[model samples]
Target: MDTNQAGPAAEEALARQEQETITQAIAKELGISVKQVRTTVGLLDEGNTIPFIARYRKEMTGELDENVLRDIEERLSYLRNLGDRKKDVLRSIEEQGKLTQELQEQILKAVKLQEVEDLYRPFRQKRKTRASVAKEKGLEPLADWVMEQRRQGQPLEEAAKYIDAEKGVESAELALQGAMDIIAENIADDPTIRSWVRQYTASQGILVSEAKDAEQESVYENYYNYREPVHKMPPHRILAINRGERENVLKVGIEVTADKIHAFILRKLVKGPSPVKELLEAVTEDAYKRLIAPSVEREVRGEMTEKGETQAISIFSGNLRSLLLQPPVKGRNVLGVDPAYRTGCKLAVVDDTGKLLEVAVTYPTPPNNKKREAAAKFKELIAKYGIQLIVIGNGTGSRETEQFTAEVIAEIGDPGLAYLIVNEAGASVYSASKLAQEEFPDLDVAERSAASIARRVQDPLAELVKIDPKAIGVGQYQHDVSQKHLEESLKGVVESAVNHVGVDVNTASASLLSYVAGVNATIAKNIVKFREENGKFTTRKQLQKVPRLGAKSYEQCIGFLRIPGGDNTLDRTPIHPESYPVVDRLFRELGLDVASLGSKEVAEQLQAQDAAELAVKLDVGVPTLRDILESLQRPGRDPREELPLPIFRTDVLKIEDLVPGMEMQGTVRNVIDFGAFVDIGIKNDGLVHISQLSGSYVKHPMDVVSVGDNVTVWVLGVDLKKGRVSLTMRPPSGNDGGAK
Candidate 1:
């Protein structure tokens, strides 16, 4: 037998053991079942996407939701990487011939990467320093003598024995200085001491900031003399302070009690009264002030920044999800308006399917003031296109354009005609892009923007996916946070939204298809190309025929790609193609034709049967069986249809029109940590502060409302000078008037 063959097997066994250890750790941290963690880890290791595992592998994961599964995936990756790093560190230490059993155990027991790094600090290679210089001078024996804490003689008297002029120790004092340097380095390198000081400083420190220019009236004025407890500070405030400091507007630092840290270190390093006790005490202070304090401060601030970025990314992700999942305004012929002043109000009339029918420009505000002419042109377009809804971009001159649109509607007396102010944040960016130019070569920037605005209301997901998610304006301090992390999180949000709602394979653009569970940019384009060449896909099986889309991609993606009128009605639903056998058996056992699905008779039959009992009969899990039954009931149903729709209006109101205690209906435009901006048919969206979000205490604005929520708010106050309008969701007192 070849002895080397066992080496590979041994390494594989070791890898498996490490993976099990990480899995067990994650299970304990998340307080989930070990079996669940193991199964999820196995599935993720098998290259199944999070959405696929969450939706399809319920039996393996014990029905963990997407959020939990994602958490598991992140933790698993982190722990596995940490374990690998630990192994590397251990190997390096062992190779140096300095590894001890105690140190090995400590490294193995470390929970965080920081903890492992701290343990490895002393062993880490360093550049030439004072300690290394002293060692180079052959003064290491003197340093060790000082560390021994001999009580029989004075340190300088003991140090004189090691003084050698040739070795650069000219005198006892010089030898003592080098010894103290070694002692300081030793104290600085103690992991236990460093860890304790870090914990103490973090718990007791205050983050203080002072304005660099106290007289300047900037947005950071509130932070001019800010001081907040490090432990209790909010993530937003930390990010704000960090930005303020980065911009040179404020000086920030962590303030901790120096005497307390010094005393603690002295008590740990000094065992008893000795000839070198005083020198050692001074070295302790020098180690902390010169070495430990600065490093610990950076670590604490870095930790805070990381935490703040995490929170900011989470907020952005949630907001993006809500914005992407807004309900589509189906079957509505709409006219889109890109509001402007000096130029003209650009218009694009799109049919219900977002197909542009006409484009024109009319001067409605400022330079021309062609109000009547614009109204006449709008009315003509409305009648010509049979336009049911008007979507106006809330940009420059939006208020005047909306007033003109309202007047046009009122004159026509078409109650069915309503206008909506769509947030056109990235419309211009999209319009000027290569994609937009390719999509519409003849249209100008404003014209393309108008079309995008119209299509946003028709189908928000489809239209918004064309623009970069970061430019969608659903986040706070998005640019200030980690761009890579933010992009990753936003992309994940879009992917989750796309997969959750599913996709119409025939109508979906490559931009939308690229975010599907298993699809990439290349595969998305290939799928669209295949569709264009081969015609509409009639069944999920046809996906495998697309070049570069293999069996794995088809299996991962086919379930989330829908065909409304396909050969298999199950294809129109979220049911996987692999489960057709179970469905066929179900239909045979029930004596029902698959074509009879969603019919009244089938609905009644499904409602009368117990899904759990049927699941056992069909040899499938209850969750899968329930999902199949739901799909059978409502084929090709859009999950977005269940969410609240965008608010529409036939009239416009200025900020001055708002009065205290007057109620009005509004649409949630953007939700942040502090409040929500609501568009209540006004030029400027009103602010619903976190405190005013509900009648009771509210933890976060998102907990009360999300983007696209149609809410009834009372006008609290309006500052027309600053163009600020404050609103509240809470009901007014008995004396206050209601909606006007």
Candidate 2:
């Protein structure tokens, strides 16, 4: 074995070690086998998408789902970045000629970038600071004498020798002061002391905040004189405090016990009593207060804020996914209304297939109450298109619009007519988007928004994909989180939702298709272009011919693309092209005809067979076989249809009408950390506090209800002046406080 190692060979050895460590670490953290992480990493390295690996390569990845595969990908990326950072730190330290073997080992063993940076702090090049100036004045020897702690003599004697008038050391007192600066810098730069102090402060420190101006009232008034332990602050509180601080409404600081921190530092540096102990104590105090305290507070707050943002982003991602996957109100002629007082309500009537039949304006409510004219126009449009449902944008004048629509339906006396208010948070954003302009070049912005609102009701996943996920407004503090991370996470959720509900290639827009696994924006646009130049895609194989859609991309994306009522019956299902043979074999072995797929008898027959035996005979994995069977049983099945539909209402309820203990059915508009906001046909959504969510303990609001969930709630109280309603889901308990 060569004692001295360098260059590519040494790099190879280190790379091998790092890779092994990453593999084991990811496995341990994710509670999966190391082999699973390795296999998944290899697949990802080969350009395999998460959806592709999760669905097509089940056996290879030990049957990991898309979420798990994505988690592995995320962790692998982070660890690889950490490894690269460690290598850079090592190189920087080695170049400084200060890298010791123990230091090298410590740096190699460091798990986080923060730890590596801490170890590198001492050797890091600095600007001309007091410490650097002292070192220039030859006071480093005196500083070393203080650190050694073995000599029982005064440090001034040692510091006196370093007093050179030429290099700015004028007097013994100035020399001692210069040495003190060096000693303080050394103590501050020591990785061990910094790490210990940071951990201790984080654990014991109290985060305190006061209102910048207590007389001024705002939403954050509750935080005017708030105090919470740094480590115990919840994610929502962290975000709240951050927002308050940013708005200049609060003064926030971390309060640590100075006595404890000083005692710990003294015990570490001031070993047995020595004459330099007092000097060391003074230097330690100087190091903590002047050099380390501010940075440590910032670092702790940064870490806490990062964790809070991660949590908030995760919640937003989940809510967005749920909202996007809401069941499509198919086969209903929808009338979309963009409510406005000044501009009049923009109305778009879209037929069952989301084709815009007409666009008109209604002044039923507001500045121009053209009741007779607006009602007549609305009635004519409804009768012309045979509208069965109304999709009202939950925007300006929404309550008035809802009331007007309810009256119109009552006047029409149609039993089938009803309305549902859909969250139009990002409709305006989409209307202003280039994609929306390209889709409807002839329409105005508000007209386009009305059309979008209608189409979203028909197919949420398809239409919601057009708007920026951040603008969707499904989560609290979404704007406060890391935008890059939030976008990536919400993108993943969209990708997962899209793949989960395999899209009909001919029907999906470019925005929706872009979220499909292995499909980029360019390819998605090319798909639409190809479909336009050529006719609709009749088979999954047609995707391979699209420009820039190479064999690999096609293979990764084709399974999630469906072509209903196409030439090949299997193409109407999620049964992949490669798996068609297996499916054909399954049908043959079961003595069933493919033409009669999705029929009750055929579905029963397929469901009755043994999937394991069929997998063996078909030579496919059990998971793949089961998926094929599911598709065969119900071709083009939508998972969303099983969820509770949005509450359809022919009548509108006002805040004044809400009485305590009045039970009403409503849809969950959004779920946050503390509780859920339910739309009980009012202008303001009611808050169902976490305590009112259920009879038992609720860890999180999302665990009980998600966005678009239909739940029956009892009104605990109504604040008419404030326009707020308190709702409960625990059967009310017949009390004003609601249920525990």
Candidate 3:
């Protein structure tokens, strides 16, 4: 064959091979057939979104789930990049006129991106370096001698005589040493060796430590004496070690056993023996010291840090999701107080819908001489607004503020009124944000914080969605992750929560509406604009008139929007607009109108009548229609209420008040790999270690409990100096009632 025709045929064969390899990798990762993976890749290459593929192309993909589809999308990007780099490498080697059958075959058969890059590195043009300088001289022949030690089986001194002394090869020993240096640099630059070392360190390396010279006593005493495998270390310990290294209290190093790694590398690059065996051994020793050791150490640390960061981000995402879905205490007028001692307390009152009614200051705590006057003003505001609840910010004087509210309610004697201590973790952060400034431009930062406290009590989900998820303070190691990854993961959590709860179309703010599954800022603003231009939506069909809303967007989001007084009964229910025809057919089959099937009892009566008969009449499946019927039975029900109501305490206790044998109620504040931290109204939270979680052995804290769980714990021990509280879920003495 001529060169041109042969070249095209060879290229076609190589491309086919690359495609087959990628298809196999994708099929293995997704647990699907190779044919299915090929079809999915073809669709993805044509610019289809994951949601679209998973929803519309079930037959082609064999019903791949969303997670599997996302994986395929990511793998496709990587494979395309590999192909682009391979073409560039072939062109560059051809330009240099060094292309050969053996080299081209090796490149084509390479499985990993790193292996391809390694084969192409020597052909790549670059700036001056130690190896380049040595090669520029007549020392290339000497370097080749060092590389051939295993094949030639020659002594190092005999190989050194071939180099010319005029080109800086002064003596036999000097030439051998210089040649060793060149070979060491080559092995260090090998991408395959670096990749292997990275994997090895990630799996088996340990982070060991010794104390620093300056600091004698530090918080990292345990880490200073500890040696943990890099992959097995928990996030908390990793963060602690990083913090210790930053403070110069410890000298950290990654310790890897050299024998295992050295043997592995030698097996790859060195065969039996030849004339140049002595020179190759010297080169290998030089490579270990000059190139491999430093590179491997750096790669190991980087991998450890990245792994810790990923695990921390996963934990933060879970906690933030739970904190956002906390149940709302809706439709009750609230009074919020930002308590203080040196400064007067800032108080704000909002009506049942969170409209600011009044704002004032009070001096009800220490250093205030007019406690009675403050008490009188509080009572007057409560009676005027008919306040049903009091929200106190859990800050400096939170307990004292709770006591003040309790005393006032007792004197007035209203049994229906109650007070709650709200978590104020991000109240200050929100108070200073641009959103807060726009909402309350004239109010002081303190007053805005007080307003947030009141709004949080009325609707925790809606108001909390306005603030950043990270600032809510439920995570254990949030600051250690990539900020972009953390933000995106937490946004997913908020989106899930908002869609699951079903927002109120008439009352939701733009911020809350933006979190709906398919809605962005522009769409949320359009919803609000439509609400303002035309009054409340009487029917969901009106949403179609809003700009930028299409069929797909409406299909995903309409079911989560609740209209209170719509034209049809299903408008108030979670049934999507597309599903409304099926529901109408259902009502027609029962000989009833939408108005007659309003209550759960009536809906159940209709459902008890034969779904298969209704499905035949309606031309729909029994499964979908049954789901629509259930949704119609309870329109706009809050799912958060199905969980336990949040626990609010009237008093705060100190660590000294707890005894070893006493049991107390506590709320879970954070969960880590080793244990859970519980807030039992004490200055120091108690730890429920993993071993004490249950009778059976547990591997992770998440296996037993999660954040916001309420449990009764028995105090096992308290170390006053260390400020550590140990707690157990096991019952004390003979009072066994199963684990809580």
RMSD of each predicted structure: 2.6, 2.2, 4.5
Cα lDDT of model 2 by residue, 251-308, tens digit: 9999999878888888888878788788887888899999989999999999889989
Count clashing residue pairs per candidate.
0, 0, 11
Residues 1-740, candidate 1: write the lDDT tens digits. 12246798887887788778888888898999999999998888888898898888888899999989988988887887898799889988888888999999999999899999999988899899888888888778888887788777888887788788888889999988888888888888899988998898789999999999999888999999999989998888989999999999999999999999999898887779888888887888899999899999999999888988898888888989989999999999999999999889999999998888999999989889999899889989988989999999988988888888888889999888898888998999999998899888999999999999999999999999999999999888888898998988898899999999999999999999999988999999999999999999998888888988877778788899999888878989999977889889989989999888888889888777798899999999988888888778777889999876777788778777779998888888888888999888877789999988887778988788888888888998999899999998888763432112
CA error at residue 416 for candidate 1, angstroms: 1.0
How much RMSD separates candidate 2 from the native structure?
A: 2.2
* Clash count, candidate 3: 11
Output the number of the lDDT-best candidate.
2
- What tens digits encode model 3's per-residue C-alpha lDDT throughout 1-740? 12356788897886787788889987887678999889888877765545445544555787776567767876777877887777778878988899888888778677667678778876788688667766765566777755554443454566467466677766666666666667777777776776787688778888887787644877788766778888888777777787788788888988887777777767766766676555566566667766777767776676566677777776776777666776777778889999888787889999988999899999888888367988998898889999878888879887677777778877778876777777788999999999899888989999999999999867788988889888987776677667887887677677767777778888888899888756778999899999999989888888888887776667667777888877866777666677777777777777766776667677678657676677778897665666576776666567887766556554446677878978888777777777888877665578999887776678877777777777888899999888889998777654532224
Pairs clashing within candidate 1: none
Which candidate tops TM-score? Answer: 2
Badly placed stretches (over 4 Å) of model 3 are: 1-27, 30-127, 150-174, 190-192, 214-217, 273-275, 365-373, 403-413, 550-552, 606-623, 719-724, 733-740
